[model samples]
Target chain A: MPKVTRYDAPRVIDSGSIWILVAAPTIWAVHFLLSYWVAAVYCAKSGSGWLGGLTDPRWIIVGLGGLSIAAIVWLGMIAVRRYGGVFVVLEEITDSSEQGRERFIGHVALLLCALSAVAIVFTVIPGLVFDRC
Target chain B: MRRGTSILFGVLFLTALGGCDGRHNWMAGAGEEAAAIGDLFLILMVGAAVIWSLVVGAAVYAHRRRAHPGLEREARLFVIWGGVVFPVLLIGALLVWGLFLLKGITADEGDLTVRVDGERWWWRVTYETPTGDVVTANEIRLPQGRTALFRLTADDVIHAFWVPALGGKMDMVPGRETTLALTPKKLGNWGGLCAEFCGGAHALMRFDAVVMAPDAFETWLAREAETAQVAADDPGFQVFLDEGCGACHTIRGTQAAGPVGPDLTHLAGREKLGAGLYEMTPEHMARWITDTHAMKPDIDMPPYPHLSGPRLDTLVDFLMRLE
Candidate 1:
C-alpha cells in the first residue's frame, strides 16, 4: 500500500483586499479638496456681494461631507466583520498565518475609517459657520 | 557637551524673541478686524505651544525610559486620547471659530468705498464721495471708527493688498475685483505693501495707510475734490506742458490728461512720492523726474536726463504745487 501525504500551504492574500485599507482616507481627501475648490471657484466667478446666496454652497458642502462619512462608516462595519468582530490595538496580529494578516489589515482599516470620519466632520465645520462668501 | 548645547539653544531662543517688534506686526491690533484676528492668533499660539510641549515631552520620555511590557494598555490609551481625541476636538473647534471670524470681518458693505487698482509699481486709488470720485495715488486715508470697503483690482498682474496693522491680506487679481473691509480703530500711519511678487519692482510697490479723525478726513476729501489751483500762465505750468510730461501724467483742471501714469491731481498733498518710497520734497521730486530708474527701477516713467537747469527745477516746483 502506498503512503498518503497531506499537502498544506498558506493561502495567498488577494491584491483586491488592500484597497479596503485606504478607501476611507481617500474619500476624506477627495471630499476635502472638492469642498474647498467648489467654494473658491464659486466665489471667484460670482464676483463680490451676494450672487445666489451663501447657503447654497454651504448645503452642497454639507451633503458631500455627509456622503463621505457614510461611506467611511460602511467600510468600518465591513472591517469589523472581517476582523473577527473584535477591535485590537494593544496586541500585534503577527502569527505568520494568512488569517493573522487579514486581521491586521482589518484593524488598520477600521482605525483609518475612524480617522476619516473625524476629518469629514472637520471639513463640514466651515460650511456651518461661514454665512457669507 | 550638554551644557554647550543648552547655551546654544538659549541664544537661539533669545534671538527669536528679539524679532517680535511691531513693524509689520499682524498682532498690532490697530483695527477692529486686526484685533479680532490677533485674539484668535493668540489663542492658537498658546494652544500650539502647550501641545508641542506635551508631544516633545512624551517623545523624550519614550526615548529615555525603559520599556514596560505590561503597559500596553496605557500606551494604547495614550494614543487614543492624545493622538486621536485631542487633535480632533481641538482642530474642529478652531475651524469653526476661524470661519465665524471670517464671516464677521467680511461684511458686505461699509460706510465708505475706496477702489484701489494695483499697478506695476504703484497704487491708483479712487475714493467715491458724495460729490464725485476723488482720485489719488499711493496713499490711503481712512477715518477712525468707520468701516471702509476696499474694492481691489489689478491693472497688470496679480498683487496682494496688505496693511499688517489693519487686517488680513486680499489678492488683487487681473480682470477681476476682490474686496476687503476694515475699520481703523487707532489713529496713526500704518504701512501698506504689495504682499505678492509680481515680477520686477514688486518690492518697491507700497503705500501709506493714514487713519485720521472723521472731521479731518472729511476736510481732506473736500480738498481732494477741488481742481488744481495753479495759475494757467505760471511759468512752471508752461514748463510742465512743454516737456511732454502731460503725455503720461494727469493733473486735474489742466490739459495734462495722458492716463498712462498716476494722477498727479493731489501730488503735493500726499505724504510720500515714488509710491511711498521717498519723502515728497522738491529735491526727491527733481531726482524722480531726472532719474526715474534710480528712485524706482523698472518704472514706466522715462528719465528726463536731457532736461536740466532751471527747467527741471520749474517742473519739480510745478508738481509740488499740485496740492
Candidate 2:
C-alpha cells in the first residue's frame, strides 16, 4: 500500500483540467453576445422588443465584455493561489490513495478558484470600474 | 515520475524571464542614461523581491507552527492593514517620489535652447550652434561636459526622447514643445532611443550621441561646415540628382534640397545608418538606399526596391563620398 500523503496521492492533475478552469470564465465573459442573441430571438419570435432598440448593441457588447474580463481576472488570481499551493504540496505529501484523492480535490479547487478569480478580476471588475467602450 | 523534466521546464522559464531584462546591460560602459535607469530599476526590483521573500518566509513559519491556524488574527489584520494603511502609505510614497523626480527635469533654466523634434522614426535634432548653424538630424555631436537645453516636439504622434545616461525623457507631442536639459559627463558614443511606442518600426528608432572633446567637436563642426566636395563629378552624382533624392533630402553643397529625409551633408562621417540599423559604410549605404524597407520594416523612408546593380552602386558611392 502506498503511503497516504498530499503530494503524490491521487495525481489527476493534468494540463486539460487546468485549461477547463481557464476556459470557463473566458466563455462566460464572452457570453454577452448570447444574451443579445437571445433578446433578439425573443423579439423576432414573439413580435415583442423595445429594449434592444433603446440601448445600442455596441454598448451592450462593450459592457458585457468588460464584465467578463473582470470576472476572468478574479478567477485567475484564485487559480494562482490554489494551483501555486498544490504544486508546493506535491513536494511534501507522502503518496497514498486517500491522500491522493485529497490532493486531487485540492488541485481541482485551486484550478476552479484561479479560473473564477481571473474571470472576475479581468472581466467583471473592469466592467464595473470603467465606462463602457 | 518525470522529475528532471519538470525541473528543466522550471529552469527554462527562469532563463526566459531573466532575458526580459532590457538589452541595456551595465556589464560594460554603454549608454549613460540606460546605465543609470537600468541600475535603479534593477535595485528596486531586487529590493522588492527580497522583502517579499522575507514576508513569505515568515508566513510559512507561522503556518507550520499552527499559530492561528484558522487565520482569525491574519484575517482581521489583513482587513485592517491590507484594506487601508498599506495602500495609503505605499501610494503616498510613490506619488511623492514621482513628484520629486519630475522636479529634477523641470528645474528652471532660461538660457540654453536646442529644439529636438521627433518624427515617425527618427530625431530631428536642431542645435542652435554658436556660429548660427542650426545643425539637424541623425547624429548629435556635442562637446563633452556642456549643458544642452532641448525643446522636444513631434511632427506626427507622441514620442519620447530619452538618453538614460544623460537625463530623463521628454514627450514630443505634435504641435507642442516639451523641454528637457542634460549635461553629458562622459565622452563616448552614448545611445539614445525612443522610450515611447510610436508605430511599427518604433523599436528600430535609435540614435547616437557622439560626445567628443570640445576641441575635437569643434574640428568636426568646422569640417562639416565646409561645402561637400564630391570626390569626382561621377555619374553617381547625376544618378543621385536624377533619383529625386534632392526633392526630400539636403546635401549642404549640392543640389539635394530635400528636408523630408535625413540630411546627408556629411554622410561618410556618420557612424550609423538608417537610424542605427547598420554601421555607416559605403556598402551598407547602398544596401539601405536600394531596399530600405527590407532592412527596417515600416520605416518612413521609402525603399527604392526597383533600383539594383550599377545604379545602386553609383548612388551608394556618391552618398559615401559626401565627406
Using lDDT as the measure, the top candidate is 1
Per-candidate local distance difference test: 0.85, 0.65
TM-score of chain A of 2: 0.39
Q: Give a tens-digit lDDT track for model 1, residues B211-280.
A: 9999999999998888888788989989988888889989999898989799998899998998888999
DockQ of each: 0.52, 0.02
Q: Whose DockQ is greatest here? A: 1
Model 1 error, position B127 (Å): 1.4
DockQ score, prediction 1 = 0.52
TM-scores for chain A over all candidates? 0.75, 0.39
List where candidate 1 sits over 4 angstroms from the true fold: A1-16, A44-55, A82-85, A88-91, A131-133, B1-19, B62-66
lDDT of 2 by residue, B1-323 (tens): 59999999999999987754432323223333334445556766886797689778868976788555577766667655664557556654544454444544544352345677888798776666577665557777777766667778899889998765566677888965667766666777767788999999899888887778878977887787667776446788888888888898887777777888787788777888877568988777877887788888887677787888888887887777777
Query: What are the runs in model 2 whose C-alpha is more than 4 Å off?
Result: A1-133, B1-23, B26-43, B66-91, B106-113, B164-167, B183-187, B230-235, B299-312
- Best TM-score goes to which candidate? 1
